[model samples]
Target chain A: MIAFISSFISRVMNTLFKGRKNIKLGLYGPPNGGKTTLANRIAKDWLGEEMGTVSAIPHETREIKIKEQVTIKSGKKELTFNLVDTPGIATKIDYEDFIKHGLSERESKKRAKEATKGVIDAIKWLDNVDAVIVVLDGTKDPFSQVNLTIIGNLAARNTPVLIVCNKVDLKKVKIKKVESAFPQYPVVGISAKFGTRIDEFYEALFTVFR
Target chain B: MLTLEFVPYHEIANLSSIGRIRKLLNIAKQNKIVLLEGRLKKEEEIELIKTTMEEINEDFKGIELAVIYPTKNDSGIFTKMKTNFVDMIAGNRLGLTIIGPASIVKAIKKDPTKIQLYTQELKKKARKKK
Candidate 1:
């Protein structure tokens, strides 16, 4: 009787464990769309720390950065995700471009090569991501090669997407335009730098990403 | 208060990425500068550019677009030079990207050199001089 009871209890424990799902949430976007900044913001809010460095140069983050077991709570409901912050995706990576960003000839070439590889790595990771948060620069035109590719890949894979319009603090912000650009996805406009409208972003995060 | 043409404000949250590009092209076809708030995903941007190129012939030669971001650093003269007009206009993944008429873009670029760099930095030699 004790052996039978133990087996029954084991089955019950398995069922309980299966009910709690941990998602792999991804951050994807073009170079310098503030993916790291937004990643840092979310990490800071929930994990009490930052994940990666932010820089003025493009492709500053050329590695797959992850923060495991990040659990966010909204009242009684709580969700946990393994945050995966990937490198920015781009169609082109010219060493000359990095030179324009003040890197030396050797450094620019090295960075460009790494960035290209990073783009490939980021694409390969799409299959593993449960959902994605696309971070975009608020003041820029939303229609571009990089932005379209990321959204298209996500749609093709049937992964949920949350588009974050970062840098609303800028003077020329047109969040409505971004809202219009990707009418299908939930677009949250926040100054990730200053944490403006971040609460709304978090609330939207729960509703949309969940 | 800004209305997004046919897509109702609330309903926009349901339009697919393709639908948004369609709407964007329609607006751009009218010769209006479509200032999209956020940077686009790579594929969406690619399709937009491809479809845009295909549609260009008589009425529209191209479209002019730019991406703007808030000042991150107090950029020094050298740093500004690094991302100078030639560099930023050409290399920025996001920046003041203009894809419209060459004539208009030319007029826009007629006096780019006059624009001031974000912030100034003391020259290394000047520091030693002082």
Candidate 2:
């Protein structure tokens, strides 16, 4: 009788203590949607370092980048998770597009090829991540194929998602459009570049992951 | 010869993710390779891994999945022609992934020159035992 009671108590304690630690939080979105910018912001706020470089050109992050041992606290709640910043997901990747941006024929084609490989690497990383943040450009329409594909994939895994409507520092950004498009998930608007409304993001992160 | 059925991405795209994955698993269990055009939906891929892991048994081992992409290069007209031709027919040819029973892929080698994916037949003993 005493052994049975002890086992029950131990199991309960394990469940409670296993609250949240070493979580893998992934940043996923289309090209130039401020994903890396947000990753930098999060890392700068916590770890005092940048995750990866960002560029106006699409798919600048042509690989999966990880920042480990990040711990964030909001009021009484705290989250410790590895931040995984992935390359943008695109439906059509054309080398010609890169050439149009004044890159050399050789350079553009090379970037396009690397970017294409990066998407597959990012998608493969999906299985291991604990949760995902689907970052979107608030100025653009939220109903693009790449955006829908990302959400659909997240939905399929039933991964807890926090939709980030980024680039709100721009005057054209419409947070409502993003919210309406993905009504099921919680949407938080922030200018990751300018670090606006970042505290709310931290609070929401605690809420969503809690 | 690789004994596998081609599941057109458009056909499988319409099914619920679970249904699509279940359908893919059925093909894998039949001891045949699955040449799927395009890529599986993100969720479908994730669920496919989960289901594949759960269904491991004596008859089947694990899955060996591969994506085939044309060698990408920047300088030559030949490279441009090949890249454009593949894109016109296969959409994003880079997105194509091949999934098959691991029993066959274990012995074959990646030649990088000849056949990109060398699909061999499963062992006779494993099939006969079942």
Number of the top-ranking candidate, with lDDT as the measure = 2
Worst 10 residues of 1 chain A by lDDT: A1-10
Worst 10-residue stretch by lDDT in candidate 1 chain B? B110-119
Candidate 2 chain B least-lDDT 10 residues = B106-115
> Highest TM-score: which candidate?
2
lDDT of each: 0.66, 0.74
**Model 2 over residues A1-210: C-alpha lDDT tens digits?**
434533443354345337656678999998899999999999999999999999888879999999998999877776888999999875335565577888898888678667767777777788888788899999986765457657878777767788999998999999987876676677899999998999989987776665
Candidate 2: residue A89 Cα off by (Å): 0.5
DockQ class, candidate 2: incorrect
Error of 1 at A88 (Å): 0.8
Give the TM-score of chain A, superposed on the true chain A, for all candidates in the order listed. Answer: 0.88, 0.89
* Candidate 1 lDDT by residue in tens digits, A1-210: 434533443344345335557678899988898889988998999999999999999989998999999988889866678999999876445565578888899998678667766776787788788778899998876765357557867877767778999899998888887776666677889988899999888877666655
